[model samples]
Target: MVSKVKIYVSGRGQFAVQVAEALVEARHHVVGVASPRLRDGHSDESQAMSWDRLRAWAYPRNITWTDSSELRAHHIAADVDIILAAHSHAFIGRRTRARARVATIGYHPSLLPLHRGRDAIRWTIRDGDKVTGGTVYHLTEHTDGGPIAAQEHVLVPPGSTAQSLWREHLAPLGIRLLLRVVDDLAGGRRIEVPQDEELATWEPSMDSPPLFKPELIALPGSVSVDSSKWALHGQEGRDHSRPGSTA
Candidate 1:
């Protein structure tokens, strides 16, 4: 039998809510959420579901939540088995991570050891990469440098915008990998693979200017994907427009 763990979520936007919902569906107790302000109503059609949606979903169910600023500014005292970071910009410090019984896991929208930064999806498009993927990794002081828990590659279609790529592929991959990692942890079968630093590449934030020339690096585990079959349709909270920064 698998144990249902207590989890604290750290993130914003639709992706974060999706993570919280998945955890609940998996029978894990979402003890708390540390994200942005929880608005009083649903997000407008133009906007992806924000922290407001999370507020609506969590409050009725009695899931306690606090602002991400608190998590960033000071230590949180939640007695959680794991801290799951999904699309969260705030940093989860060492002291906070130490509170988790298992480990703090984060979802990054790129293959580990590559595109390790705030604007991974943007960099993927700007660099003209044909392949990219998502990673679920243990969180550490190093940015997106934690040891990998799980990873899967996907294809980047020609002329694919960051919004489309993220909504269609990376986001779903992130949800699947995160759940898988959590389940493995609960079942005592969690795996951790150390990343090769030689293969690692870090890019600047979206605010920074684009690189003049693309850097060539060997992608080992990437496989070609038939994007038509993987194409996802309308879903509530899906961000249609390109995001400024996915950090």
Candidate 2:
């Protein structure tokens, strides 16, 4: 039987919204959302878009929300069962994470230890790796180096671009894995598998110039997904990775 789990979700974009929606659909209590500020229309394109999507979804549903800055400063609810970081750019401070009843977790779209950076999808395409995967891992001080809770692999088909790969495989794959882990946690399963440091790999930031030639890009005026190395769902940072950084 699945117990009602109280959750605090922090992140940006449609991915984060979907995660929140999935949890609620599963009958979980979503205590609050920490998203980028929408009112400050003076932010970057990505932040602005994130705020818009998050605001539109959260407001109508009456989900309590605060800007990421406030989230970093305050204590998370004492009753929160989990803290889920999805495609978030801001870091959820340790004090906040400590309040979760179970654990704080985040999603990354690579077979971690392999692609431990902001732009795993782009790097995977550049490296030409035939197999890559998604991981739902515990949040730690290390970037994407936390112990694994659950992971599943996805194949990179021929002629796969970062955009196609995410749309066709990684995005949905992340949602599936994340929900599965949430279910496991609610069922009293302890699924922490420490990653092997020896096998770990780190790619350069998404800001770096692309090594892959003629990179497939989104058409102008279309909903932008992958631009240069930037991913549609994640933002770049030292303490974070795709779908976003750890809590």
Candidate 3:
């Protein structure tokens, strides 16, 4: 039998819950969970698990759960082997990241070096990219700029919406990738791959207006005019986007 690693998770939304549940089911010790309080009573449609549901699940398992606007290093114990950031808005500082025995892993909806910021999915759909995907990488203070551990490409069917793409492809792919990365690490595999800076691209925060305007265009050899547009930063001619791309 393989030894189980101790894990601490930080983030909100269903993705976080899914990671937590998987870790527990795999026999890993879940030390704690740090999540942001749900502002207002509005439920984010993109999230598969609710805060209440997560709390209920954790409490019965005797796990530590914390809900706050920020998750500091003090909130987590020093014995954790890995810190998983799943859809978390707060940045994990160097001090906190150092507490883990291994590196802090983060789940970004878009493939790194492209669509690095928020709303990657919306941008991809708006830009009419033929493919998009997810990545699990080491987290740094520089946003999703850490070295990648794993990535899976997904084809964007014609007329795809941000919600449909996430529900059908990105979310499931992300879960599988995260689990695979954890398994590799636990089995003593060093899988970090540094990203190429020259090919990197990024998007704005979720609060900002979409970086591109949707327009109708005809794909070569196809009679249908698909909705597409040029990205604001002028990083075009590639396949990219995110699961939670809508701000």
Candidate 4:
């Protein structure tokens, strides 16, 4: 039988709730959940899994929930085994990571060693990449620099948007990857593979300037291609179309 571990979840949005649900379904003890309160202008998915709704769901299941913008080490229980950061914007301190008995893992929308920053899905689409994926990795002080635990790739359909990619591909794949990683940990297995720093590429944050200017390519018969080939002049630009760009 797989041993159940004590887990603390920190994040907001549908992804976080999905992870928490999966943990509970796996019979893991969810000690606490720290998430931001719902606000206007939040994404539809996030609003669907707001703190208040999660609290109601969790309370009935005997899971403690807290509404906090950030999760600190002090917020965690003494016997917490793992801390899972799912779709969280808050930066987890090194001290908090150390507090966990097993590890503090994070879910990244892009494959590690590439697109290691905020708005990974947006960047992938902006770059017009043919493929993209998700990564479940150990969390460190450095952003998305932690060693990888599990990864899965999906082909980016032509004219795919960030929202579509996330909803259709990355989100589902990420959940499965996270569950597999948790199972590995539960089975007393170390599953970290060191990331190659030399091959790493960092994308601009979500609030940064647009990565590429869309160019409408006239294709045969009423079909047009939204190509990301036209680089926005006067910005730090890199050719993401090159090989090894996506997962």
Highest-TM-score candidate: 2
lDDT of 2 at 130: 99
Candidate 2, residue 67: Cα displacement in angstroms equals 1.4
Per-model TM-score versus the true fold: 0.78, 0.80, 0.78, 0.77
Put down candidate 4 lDDT per residue, 124-196, tens digits, no spaces. 8888889878888888645576789999888998877787778777878877988888888888886889887
- Model 4 TM-score on a 0 to 1 scale: 0.77
* Alpha-carbon local distance difference test for all models: 0.71, 0.72, 0.68, 0.68
What alpha-carbon RMSD in Å does predicted model 4 have with respect to the real structure?
Answer: 9.9
Best by lDDT: 2
Q: Summarize candidate 3's per-residue lDDT along 166-194 as a digit string, tens digits.
A: 87888778778877888888878858899
Scored by lDDT, model 3 comes in at 0.68
For residue 180, what is the lDDT in candidate 3? 83
In the predicted model 1, the residue pairs found to clash are none
Residue 90 accuracy (lDDT) in model 2: 68
Candidate 3 has its poorest 10 consecutive residues by lDDT at 213-222
Let me know the TM-score candidate 2 reaches against the reference structure.
0.80
Backbone clashes under 3 angstroms, per model = 0, 1, 4, 0
Q: Answer with 3 or 4, whichever has the higher TM-score.
A: 3
Off by over 4 Å in 1: 38-51, 72-78, 208-244
